[model samples]
Target: MRLTILAPLVAALFIAFTQPAQAERVDSGVPGMLFDHDVPVAMNDGAKLSINIYRPDKPGRYPVLMLMGPYGKDTTMADAPAYRTSWAKLIAKYPDLCKKSSCRYIRFEAPDPERWVPSGYVVIHADVRGAGASPGVLDPFSPRETQDYATLITWAAHQPWSTGKVGLLGTSFQAINQYQVAALRPEGLAAILPWEGAFDQYREIAYYGGILNVAWQFWWEHQVVPNQNGNAGTPLIDSIGGGKDTGLPLSQERLKDNRIDPVGAFARHPFDDAWYHERTPDGRRITVPLLDVANWTDWSTQGYLAAASRQKWLRIQTGDHLTPFYSDQALALQKRFFDHFLKGIDNGWEQEPRVAVQVRHRDGTTWRNEKAWPLPDTNWEPYYLDAASGSMGPTFEAAAPAAKSWPGLGEGLTFTTAPFVNETEFTGPVALRLWVSSSTADMDIFAAVRLIDPEGRDVTFMGNSDPNVPLDLGYLRVSHRAVDPANSTAWQPFHPHVAAEPMTPGQLYPVDVEFMEPTSIVIPKGYRLALTIQGTDFGYGPGAPIVHAKDYDLPDDSHSGLFFAAHPNRDPALYGGTDTIVTGGKHASYLLLPHVPPRS
Candidate 1:
């Protein structure tokens, strides 16, 4: 935790000049855009949070697009090495990314001020308390942080340069908080666009089907801690303030005392209890106009469906997460959405289709607009798994009872469908119903829906972080198989991870595993669809190894880097052993897919 220290006199000098609540105006580097640096907005608790504003130089009144998060407002995309490398690769791939705008003044995962300011919008980036220039405890997504956001939304709306209408926009962390504060129905909050942001903290992120995802621990340690407000060693320099220090430096012990350990909190509360509920958004209360964007390769799907807004739309696109957000086409779509909602323009946006899906095929992608998600004409088909021949078909083969056994830490089994007789499309939610027995007290199940080409090669796509990701993935721990009947649907089963019911060794138990997100892929006449059942995380070759020695052991290079769901912390005595999948006259193990017919 040691950081680069400044001389005592120099440190004191920097604090005296930088910690004040004065606003400094400067050239925004982008033509026609003005920068207001270190603008402080008072929170309800009397603490002033720092915000940097970017707007048209001669703005009368314009709609506001605000992005608030722990990622420092002064931190440009190039400030973080990881982001810088990714941005370079993205630019190399998509040459037209920055054609319309200069791409300058773009913060990580936030909107580019250069792009939006010239579009008659005021762009504001606020630092969450305890991060960047804001001062307070650095507890992210807590009730206090949510309240600060709501207050800021209202404050921005009433500003002299604002049209009294504010719309929320950004990706990931920036998009996540929009759901929380929007639930409060703050005044002048016109609309929100949450792109690839997880809604349910417990199910979607912390615990994936009751299996702990260790990525959050890595995220906090590697990405978050270094950017705390008082860290002099923060790589980010104030680009707007002529390369000044982002914040005053604080002692290591003081920094540690100022922030709560999120990973520890997650370990303590494994269930979907009040602590998680407090952080998750109550979508029923969100009545603002909403445009929820999802990536075909990411795991954020529930926000649009959960929102109660009458004027809501879902746009599911393809490609890696951050790249798509800054693409030319995505920018146009975002501008159209904001123009209709925030600017009160009659742009016929309301008349457009409610759902837009990019149907992917081996050749390319086809954009299709639908009236609703899961398509009204979705044919929910079940392909029964036959363990005897490792095959899957529509009808269950009424043969003698059979079972397939695989070690808990090994590559389990794959059931392949006979090649498609006709070009077929499967483009929505997927589920798996299985009857299983574990040699140990409990077992972890990892299921992947994949595509096999006519040449017998595995078809993979670029995931949010992983370069090779399957069509869809699902996970379930036998101990946490208790389903909530009220929330469970035919295609999606909702598991209430409140209590863990240990499985009796050698006894069969039926469980429905729900894929975290929907997928869209079109199979050619000869292409085949496959279902892989495994114990550990799904990977390219032999898959992730089960290491019981260390609790926080990360996956090797062979596994999906950030998206791997390996539960190393679980007791080996209880989870290690052989797992059996039985399919016969009564067991009826099957894979459920959404078969969408082509539009006329």
Candidate 2:
């Protein structure tokens, strides 16, 4: 922690004097926009990062908006197969896109230079170490990489055309890096708009809920990061500009030496160990203003609930992971935030609601502004479960205890509530409290929350990894359910996931599994909410589309595989046993929810 605090001060001074006052400038002759390609920026550690600058063609200072990630800096939105699928359609949706020019220089997640340059802002994009033309090892999300990002922010602040103020923006890869960099408290980093990214690399990405899912490891290491390796003829670099002409490239040996084995590293350290803690953000140290945006569709929203900052605003949007970043409503709100902070504009941002949520329903969505997350008006209620009847309701009999047992690999039990008499909304995080037992020493709990329409059809929404996923999902290795009391809240239980405390065979243990992803749904008169508790990952029935839309080529497969299959905690030799759900009397099992009343 002290390292993050101390490095920023030293780096700040170095940035002030390193860059030339009026060194090199390129005039695009396109009126308001100028392009500076393959600009080499030096880092404190003697590494030169390949950066591209986009700003007003005229000679004047402007606030800088920057992004740094492994995705090659030369990777254009038009060249990537995943992005080309919807780039044209997405651009058409936002008429404000490239309002001044053709927006030809837009990257996958970076802001459109065409729109920002004319607005008196500079947009800088960089390829971090071991990626693209940048030399060094690709240690994604490590402290070294974070320091490199901090240095880049300071370097931008001292540029000839800079206002000495910087802000970070981008989605997914770009957004996820902001948390770690901000934790360092970079000198010129005035604000951050982390539009839907995970703050905790281990729990959120490497091993979700203490279960190992190598799909991401395989996808990222094999395709995404390698695509941007510091090789001479990388496809992205070649497409943007001749690879050899862009920047200096490293030899094959250097690229391999710099890269870390993410898959092997994850499998080696199954628990929340020092490696993970080092890479994760120290949220308590963050002091900059934050406009964190997440979506119900992307269940990957732990950061929204975990981020700690004095000037922070949370917005929950609807749609897939990429949709929120491209939405017109989201873009305007982001511009307003950056305007107020980086540009020092009197945009009335301080008066805006601290939390803005877009609640979803079967037919459409509704926007609501509140003073805080888990609105002060939230009515915390519990729906008790009856194992004997496989039903859930407001109350359950306590005298007669009932227990239901299911195979560790089976579908398990589902409890649904009675039809609602009036429109009621279930908003915010949810958790399940139950007394569970495993025939073996361990059991994996996979729970999902879904809505059942009057016609008895299941309601699905877009998920960060899968298109048609349940409203919310939770996972817990019964033995690893130890909560970090300091970080845990009633609505969102924080499982340290530091180690596994194997269960006593056939012995019931009380535990709470909290679904970090928030759900906002209105239950109409005839609708019901269902809680499905299963042992394996949930899957859509036969004939159902694997995903609802053409999604970005993220490596994580959230659709049909058991997250525990590759994990030691779920070893068949020790895990394939019957799990029992005990309910009633002393062992009261129930689902806790946030019930929000309609606005007056």
Candidate 3:
């Protein structure tokens, strides 16, 4: 009886292993459209990666638009359970999302094949080395992954029914890798569009001013791990056929062994080092034409300015990161860009303005085109801080030195400006200089620029991910305050973050904090601009709480999902002490803002 029982179980396992894998051919549900899934492309190391192709059924040769990322290429927007809420909100806000096509075939943060294929383009999506259907070790944005992306680009260019030119398109993760691969200057790469993606891995995301963003732990556990290759119970299933979208299943222990722990890596390396340098893009090496789209409240313009591309354009828009990329207006802009660069259509794209900004006002936003960033005629003005009266103003008059103190881990201080007498527009980078002292050896400073209405209500806007966000934000750890003199500018201070210089307790030191990203706001008459200097993460107002990383806990009174700088491993003895800000006479502290003048 024991032999009989064992024989059946062994037979079942043998049969499961003997069956051939299913072919990935399905009707694209669109006239004259062909869908080819799981096309293999080999790397130099003999590792095979998979890609999905959507092209016109009668195509001879066409320019290619590609997206390569860890997000599953096989997972459709309508079928992805993880993005259910985001998809619903997208549809509710933009009902015309399906007017061009059913929108069922569009992958998350990727282009809709139905929209591009009919317009004489071949759209392709690839599963990065160790995600989705591809099988390998999972390491995101690694040098090895960048190499594989370059290899894929060459492969797409030489395909039987493809043009030699390929253009990169997508949002967020899809866009982040574009910068890295483009730096390689790979063959057949015609152009790139990096939208709302950070170029500096260390400064922009992992460690904001030397303070670790623990929310990355949540991002890895929730968004990335579930879609990792060989994950056993991935919720993402093939929309055309009901089955797992990832590869064969692996045990939880095996899965853990095959991937790098991003959070653990971040904890080990607190400074900018070789590990981050290997992952970040060297913009000087990127020579392809570029169209960099930045959200007004999200990423910065550093990457755009660093690129060596002579034919480059910048468009700054106001909206959450994902919505604007798929809007009808944005879609048209992308098509026109690709049509000129990839197809050599001569669509007058070269004549387009170098900078396009959607200037945010009290009621809404307005469009403005300029020849360059920071507006050539910008008036760099200093607003002096007054510690005695908790006020900030344009003029600086000598007065007796004064100081204000607050708990290091509590709501610190707010210096408000008198209500404006005229409509004032602040349309560029911002910097904050402060003379600070801590009771302990070190402290962290969190600064935010906020708008106050005539009725004293705080004005907020929808950020990249969070609904309620301030005008702009900056952070600095007093210990890691060394600035790179070569890169330091009046409008922006570049921190090398190479070493930590612990502070002498109660000894005042001046630190300049750059607001990393730019903002465009028009303050109307009777409105006040306030700067809040705090020790903890900026709190969110009443609205839908940041749901993306809600599982992560914050400090007692602080609540934030994005731009979270509260480190879990920080020592209370070192950072949880009283903090002081000094201002007046010799110790002058002020906020530097870029004031743009009206066009002639």
For all predicted structures, in order, the TM-scores are 0.92, 0.90, 0.93
Highest TM-score, which number?
3
RMSD of each: 7.5, 3.5, 8.9
User: 2 or 3: which has the higher lDDT?
Assistant: 3
- lDDT string, candidate 1, 1-600, tens digits: 000011011211112221224678876667788888878877656787899888898949999999898877776666675478667756876787677666667777888888788889999899999988888889978877887787787778777788989999998888888988887677778999999888888888788888887777767776677678787776666665645334678888989898877867878888888888878878887789999998776647688988899999998877678877887788888999999998888999988789989888875688998989878999999899999999998866575578999988876899999999998999999889999999998999988888887777777766676656778888898898999899988899999899989899999999988577888988889989889998887777544322211132233354553455544466777677899999978998999889998779
Residue 163 lDDT in model 1? 90
lDDT of 1: 0.80
Query: RMSD to the native, candidate 2?
Result: 3.5
Order by lDDT, highest first: 3, 1, 2
Q: How much is 541 displaced in model 1, in angstroms?
A: 3.7
> What is the alpha-carbon lDDT for the whole of candidate 3?
0.81
Off by over 4 Å in 3: 1-24, 541-561
Best of the candidates, lDDT: 3
The reply for model 2, stretches above 4 Å from the true place, is 1-18, 21-30, 86-101, 232-237, 242-254, 299-308, 397-399, 544-569
- For candidate 3, the clash count comes to 0
Model 1 misplaced regions, further than 4 Å: 1-21, 96-99, 242-245, 542-557
